[model samples]
Every structure is written in C-alpha cells, then in structure tokens.
Target: MKHLRFLNKYFYKYKWWIIPGVFFVIISNIFGVIPAQVIGHAFNLITENIQIYGLFSGFERREIIYDIFSYSLLYFGALVLVLYLLRGLFLFFMRQTIILMSRHIEYDMKNEIYAHYQELSLGFYRRNNTGDLMNRATEDVNRVRMYVGPAIMYAINTGVLFLLVIYAMFSVNTTLAIFCLLPLPVLVVIIYFVNTMINQKSEQIQEQLSKLSSFVQERFSGIRVIKSYVREPYTKKVFAEESEGYKQSAMSLVKVQALFYPTMLLLVGLSTILTIYVGGKQVINGSITPGNIAEFIVYVNQLTFPVSMLGWVTTLIQRASASQKRINEFLQLKPEIISGKQEKRAINGNIKFENVSFTYPDTGIKALRNVNFEIKQGQFVAIIGRTGSGKSTLANLIMRMYDVEAGRIIIDNTYLKELNLQDYRNQIGFVPQEVFLFSDTIKNNIAFGLDTVNDNEVEAAAKNAAVYNNIIDFELKFETMLGERGITLSGGQKQRVSIARALIKEPKILIFDDCLSAVDTRTEEEILNNLGRIMNNKTSILIAHRISTIKNADKILVLDDGQIIEEGTHNELLQKGGAYAEMYQNQLLEEESQSV
Candidate 1:
C-alpha cells in the first residue's frame, strides 16, 4: 500500500470523476433496495386480499375481488421493474465517471514513465533490460488501472449495498437480522486469510510474467541469429520451459482464485438459510408477517452479488499493489544525468582537454589517462590508434555522454558542463563506429537530425556522403522504407545513410569514429574529398586505423595504451621515424605486395 500510495495524486487530480461516481453509486443502491421493499408490500397486499376474497366467498362479487387483486399486483410489478431500470441507469453513469477516469490516469502514467525514461542517463539503460522497462510502463500501468477503476467501483458498491440492506433487515425484525448476519463475520475472517495467499501468489505471477516477457523479447530480437546458427531447437526448448513455469504460477493463483467464489456463495447461502429458519419462527410466533420474511429474503439476495465481489475486488487490489510497487521502483529513482540550466550559445568547436582522465563506470577500465589535447576551430584533426587505444572514448567525451572524472573539457572557452547539454549536442554531428538507423524512409533517415527538412536537402546530404547514386538506383528512391535498424540496406549503404543524417544538420563540428570502414577505399576517398570541400570552415575529427585515411590531416595524433605517443603532421612524424613512420612503412609494403 505504501507503493500504491503513489497514485494518490491521481485520485486528487480526478476528484470530479470520483465525487460524481460516488453519488451515482449511492443513488443506484438506493434504487436497488427500494424494489425489495416494494416486493414485500406487494406480497402483503396479495395475502390480505386472499383473506378478503376467501371470507367473501359467500358473496356474489368475488370475481370483482380477483380483478382488483390482479390489477394491484400488476401495478407493483411495473413499479419494481422501473426501480431496477433506474438502478441500472445509475450504474452506467458510475462506469462513465470512475472507469473513464482510470483510462485518463493510465495515459498520464505511461507518458510520465516514458518521459522519465528519456531523462535517465546511459548507465540506467545499461543496468536494466529493455523488456523490464517496457513491462513497467505498459503491463504494470494496466494493473494499477484495475485498482483505480473496477476494484474501487465494486468496493464502493458493496459498502453501500451492505449499509442499505442491513438497515432494512434490522428495521424489519432485529432478532432475525442478528441471526441472519451471523455467518458474515466468519466469511470475512476466511476471506482475509485467503486474500493473503492470493496476494503472495499474485506477486509471484507478476514477477514470472516479467521474466517470460523478457525471454520472448530477447529471442525475437535475435531471431535471425538463432535461425542462422540452426539453434532453433535449443531456443524452442528454453521457451517451452519458461512457458511451463509461467503456467504453473498462473495455475497456483487460479487455484487460490477458485476457492473464492464457492466459499463466498456458501457463506452467503448460510445467511439465506439462517434468514428462513429464524424468520419462519418469527412468523409462526406472530412476531412478523409472511411478507416480512419475503422482504428480508429479497434484501439478503440483493446483498449477495456485492458480497461475492469481495474476493474479486480484493484480488484486483492486491495485484495492483504488487504492480505499483514495481513501477514505484523506477518512478522514485532520480536520473543520474541532469541537464544544465544554461542558455543556448553559438558553438565554434574549439575543444581543449586539460589533464583529462576517465574510467568506464560499469567496466572499471581506465580508457584515458592524464590526456591533454587541443583542436582549434575549423582544423581537421585525425586520431589513429590500435583497437583499445581510447579513440571512441575521446569522441564520447566531446559529445558529453559522460562527464569527465579527473579533468575538465572546455568548448570555445566555456566549461563543457556549463553549456546547455541539448544545445551543445545539437551543434555537433557524430557518426559512431557502429551506425544505427531507424526503420523509416531514406529521406527521413537522412533528414533525422533536423526538425523540418526538404527533399532537396536530403538529396544534397546523400550526395555528399557518396550514397546518392545507390539510393537513386532503388525503384522507390528516397521513398523506399527500411526494415529494422535499416536492415534493408547493405552495410556500406547503412553507413552512408548514417553519414547523411549527420551531414544534413550542417553542424559546427563533425566527428567520424571509423565510420568509413564499411566502404571501399575508393568510396572512402570520395566521401573524404566531399568533407574537405563542405567542412572546410567547420572542425572535423576523423578516427580511423588506416594510415592512408589521415595522411593529409592538418594534425595527426597516434594513441597507444590510453596515452598519446606521437603528434605531428604526417611528414613531421615521418621525419621523426618513430611509431607513426614504422606503421606507415609497414602499410606501404602491404599495399605494394598486394599490387604485385
């Protein structure tokens, strides 16, 4: 319930729905109980007339008495029909209010959770699985909706019906009422303990269901791999095992649920039996009329459905509590990354790292150690390094994905953290080693960096990336849609499309983190030639392993083991004849031998 308390604000926010809904609940119950009273009076009318007609059997007008009794009964029947109709009408209104409010709250809850997910840092995503996040937003929110809607509605209905029915019974005959209600307290105690079991089992079911969903989601995401590796049998066996576990958990909950209705009806039946027995004695002793017995029975039966809903409503609420607790786990978390409040400013891409050091938070690997570098605006800088030489780490720091631990980064003389985060990222175009594209049209994918774009601009960027010819060869051209992660395109095509996405922004700084590896050397040279023409006035940083790619860079930095070992123009490093020169001579030999 402490976790369930998170929804209290929603209850307050939608109070209008609740207040009107409560009014209708009370009104509907009032109308519902009135019919029982009418039936009682109608019974008494029939009995009294039966006595009259019998006494007047010697009279010549007994047929007239029969007609009078028939008319009176017909009127009472119509009145009872109208009463039930009114009750049903109010019930509809009750649903319109309370149930409708629950849907609104569901919409709000999902958006709130999704927005929170967006604000969370990369570490948060790394720590939690995608399926778990999705389940909390969707399935868990649905459970909470049940508590706010149907469970609350039924609980209110039961309470109001009990009050009205009990009052009517006691008013008629206190002794019969006392005896009739004796079975109810025992019913409560039994349901209380049963509900405890229900709560535990329901929580277990929810947990297992999350796990099952995660398993299925992960399998589908890697379906291609599973099929390619011919491991379908293995995956199928694991899926079957997970499904069996889920079924067992569900059946356990169902078994507990199965106990609810029968036990509920049985106790209600006992109350009915008590009513007839005690009520018959009262009638024989001249304490009440036979009509009073009829009325009491009607009242008890009126309470029957509401009382039966006890277990179901309790089960819904219990499950909802379990779900809300899971949701609160994420809702209560403060995002590790908070955006700066600084206003947006123009970026000139003069980046300097002073005494910078960083370690991966999750892996605990020191990626950069006391690194210092400076890149002036509009300079083409290239970083060449081995596989683990911290090339990608430098690019990530420039993008401010993670804050520096030891030293500060300055962008155009402003502390990197002091600049607005969103604004800062918007001015830079980054193409990572692993390119990711959305499942959308080529035009949209190329123009994704901008809020609004035209076909001409998309084409221009595509041409700049040397992918325009490939795109135009398609029958649908720019309108061609892609599959998941742009799977419809070849590896080289995907890389070019990603490059077009970054290029369309006309950013102040462009960082290519070995994105040209997928393309042939000729295509790479063509794309780099376009970059030289288009990005002549903007800072460009290209990270690659090929010495040929960085031969013409204004400044080349060679990194090894998280530290820069050499920095100079290609010709200057050649003069030094150290690590850079040795690598250059090796690649030259490899290329010359391949030509032979």
Candidate 2:
C-alpha cells in the first residue's frame, strides 16, 4: 500500500470515471437487493392462501381466487426480473467506466516507465537485464491493473451489497441477523492472515519469474554462441531446471490460492445454516412470518457471491502491492548522467583531452590514466593501441558515454559536460568497434538518425562505405529486411552498413573506432580512400591497430597499457623506431607471408 501511493495521482486524474462507477455500483446493488425482499413478499402471499389453489374447499370461488393468485405471482416474478435486468444494465455501465479507466491508467503508467527508462544512464542498463526490465514494465504493470480494475470494482460492490443485505435483515429481526453473521468475524480474521501470506508469496513468485524470463532471453539471444560450443543438451537441462524452480514457486502460490474458495464457501454455508435454523425459532416465537425466514435466506444467498469475492479481491490487492513495490524501485532512481544547459548548443570539432582518466563503474577497471591529447579542426588523427590500452575509453569519453573520474575534457574551449548533451552528440559521428543494426530495411538502417532522408543520400553513403555493390547484389537491395543485429548479412557487410549509417550523418567530427576490422585489406583501402575524398576539412579520428589504416593520418598516437608511449606522424614514428615502428614491421611481415 505504501508503494501503491505512487498511483494516487492517476487515481485523482481519473476520478470522474471512478465517481460515476461507484454510483453505478450502488444503484446496481440497490436493484440487486430489492429482488430478495420481493421474493419474501411473494412467499408470504403464498402462505396466506396455501389452500386457495384447491378445487373443493375454495373450488366455488376457485376461478376468481386462481386468477388473483396467478396474477400476484406473475407480478412478483416480473418485478424480480425487472430488478435483475436493471442491475445488469448498471453493472455493464459500471464496468465500462471502471475497466476502461483502468486501461487508461495502464497506458499512462507504461509510457511513464518507458520514458524513465530512456532517461536513465548506460550504467542502469549495465546493472539490469533486459528481461527483468521488461517484466517490471509489462507483467508488474498488468498486475497493478487488476487491482485498479476488478478488485476495486468488486470491493465497492461487496461493501454496498453487504450494507443493504445487513440492514434488510436487521429490520426484520436483529437476533436472526446477528446470529447469522457470527461466522463473518471469524472469516475476516482468517483473511487477514491469508493476505499476509499472499503478499510474501506474490513477491517471491514475481522475483522467480524475472529470473526465468532473464534466463530464457539470454539463452535465445546467445543461441549462436551456444550452438558454436555445442552446448544444446546442457542448455536444455539447465532450462528444465529453471522451469522446475518456476513450477515450485508457482505451486507455492497456487497452494495458498487454493485455500480461498473453499474457505469462503464454508463460511457462507455456515451463515446460511444459521439463517434457516435461527429464523425457524423466530417464526415459532411469532416474532416473524414464514415470509421473513424466506427473506433472510434470499438475502444470505445474495451476499454469497460478494462474500466469495472477498478472498479473490484480497489476493489481487496483495499481488498488486508487491508488483507496485518492484516498479517503484526503478522509478525512484535518479539518472546518473544529467543533461546540463538544455538550450541547443553545437561544437566546432576542436577537442582536447587534458589529463583525462576514467574507471568503468561496473568492473572498477581503470581503463585510462592521465590521457592528454589535442585535435584541432580539420585534422586527421589516429590512435593505435594494444587491446585494453584505452583507445575505446578515449572514444567513449569524447562521446560522453561516461565522464572521466579525474581530469576535465574541453570540447571547443568549453567543458564537455557544460554543453547540451544531445546537441553535442549530434555533431559527432561515432562508429563503435562492435556494430549493431536494427531489424529493418538496409536503407532505413543507414538513414536511422535523421528524421527523413532522400534515396540519393542513402545510396551515396552506401557507395562511400563501399557497401553499395554488396547491397545491390541482394534480391531486395536496399529494401531488404535484416534479422536481429543484421544477422542476415555477413560480418564485413554489417560493419560496412554501420559505417554508412555514420557517414550519412555528415557530422563535424567523425570517429571510426576500429570499424573496418571485418573487411579485407583491399576493401578497407577502398573505404579509407573514399573517406579521404569526402572527409576533407572534417575532424576524423581513426582508432585501429593496423598500420595501413592509420599510416596516412596527419598525427598518430600510440598507447600501451592505458598510457600514450609515443606521439608522432607516420615518418617521425618510423624514425623513432619505437612501438609504432615495431607494430608496423610485424604487420608488414604478416601481410608478406600471407601473400607468399
């Protein structure tokens, strides 16, 4: 309930719908209870003239008495039928208002959560799995919907019906009403305990479901790796184990749930028996008519359905609270990377890393150490490093994916964090080392960032990336749809398509982070030459290991173990004969041996 307080705003927002729904429930219950009293009156009339239907004792006046009795009974049945019809009509209206309001609330809640997810930083994603995130947004939200809809509706209906039935019973005979209701107090105490157990079990079930969903999602996403390793049987056995765990967790809840219906029926049956037995005594004492006994019985049965719904509604409320608590966990999180100065701002391609250092938050790995460099407008710079040498870290900082733990980065003579984050990123074209493409047409994949792009621009970018021939060779060409992460294409083709996506943006700063690793040397040379032609006057930073990829850069920096060991042009590095020269010589030998 504390966690569910977050929904107060939505409840207030849809109050008009709720107000009318409550009215309909009250009116509907009024109709629902009236029929029982009508049935009681008809029973009394029948008792008054039980022998009126006889052909001898009342036979002389049988025709007139029969017509009168038949009409009276018909009128009573018609009244009951009318009452029920009205009850059903208002019930329909009640559902229309309340259930529809719940749907609206569900829509608003999901959108709010999705927007919050978008605002969160990459660290949030790193800490949470997609399946768990999805479960919170989808499954948890749906459970909360049940509380807002059916549980709330039935709760109101039960309260209203209980009051009407109890008042009717008390007016006839208080002693009988009191005696009949004795079991209800005991039922309430049992329900309190059941609700406590339900809340605990519901939380456990939700947690287990999240784990299972995550396991399935991860396994399917990495199915290619699993197949490569030939771990199919092993994965299947693990999946079976996970399924059994889920079953056990589910059965625990189901066991508790199974207690509800029988308990409700037992309490209701006890109330019914007391109503009949106690009312018989009252009739014997001349305190009430036979008709009053019939009325009490009808009223008790009228309470039966609502009484049964008590356990069900309580169960829904418990589950909803548990789910809302989970949802609140993520909603309460403040985004770590806050955007500063939202007014539109742009960069002029001048970037300086002044003693920049950073550590990955998730692993606490220091990937950079006192990195300092300067790249002016229109300069082509390349960074070369061994694996884990902080080349990508530098790129990430430039992109502002993560802020430096120490030192400050200046972009265009301003602090990187001070500028508008969205505007700053928009001016830079960054192709990460690992390529990703959406399951979409090739043209749409290349033209993703922009609001709209013409076909010529898409084709020209593809040609510049040297993937135009490959795309056109396909049956659907640019219109071809890809599988997830572009699995429909080869590795080299996917990399080239990703390059085309960045190139099409025509950004002021182009950072290609080892994007050409999958293509052959000849194709890489072709792509680089195309870049050289179009990339004039644009700040291009190429991070790669191969010398051929960075040999033509205006300046080259070599990194070793998170620090830059050498910085020079290609000729100056050869003269120094340091790490850069050593790498160039080794790569040349490998190429020569391959040719031989």
Query: Cα lDDT for residue 177, model 2?
Result: 94
Give one digit per residue, the lDDT tens place, for model 2 in 1-596. Answer: 88889999999999999999999999999999888889989999998866556644635677778789989999999999999999999999999999999999999999999999998988899999999999999999999999999999999999999998899889889999998899999888989898999999999989988998999999998999999999999999998998888899889888887987788889889988998899999899999988888888888888889988988999899999999999999999998777768577656798898888889999998898998889998899999989999999889888888888999999889888888888888888889999999999999999997889999999999999999999999999999999998999999999999999999999989999998889998999999898887788889999998999899999999999888899989999999999999999999999999899
Among the numbered candidates, top TM-score falls to 2
Q: Give candidate 2's TM-score.
A: 0.97
TM-score per model over all chains:
0.95, 0.97
lDDT of each: 0.91, 0.92
Model 1 whole-model lDDT (C-alpha atoms): 0.91
**Worst ten-residue run, lDDT, model 1?**
332-341
Runs with alpha carbons beyond 4 Å of true place in candidate 1: 582-596
Clashing pairs in 2: none
Write down the RMSD of all candidates, one decimal each. Answer: 1.9, 1.5
- Candidate 1 residue-wise lDDT, 359-380, digit = tens: 8898898999889989999999
Candidate 2 stretches with Cα past 4 Å from truth are: 51-58
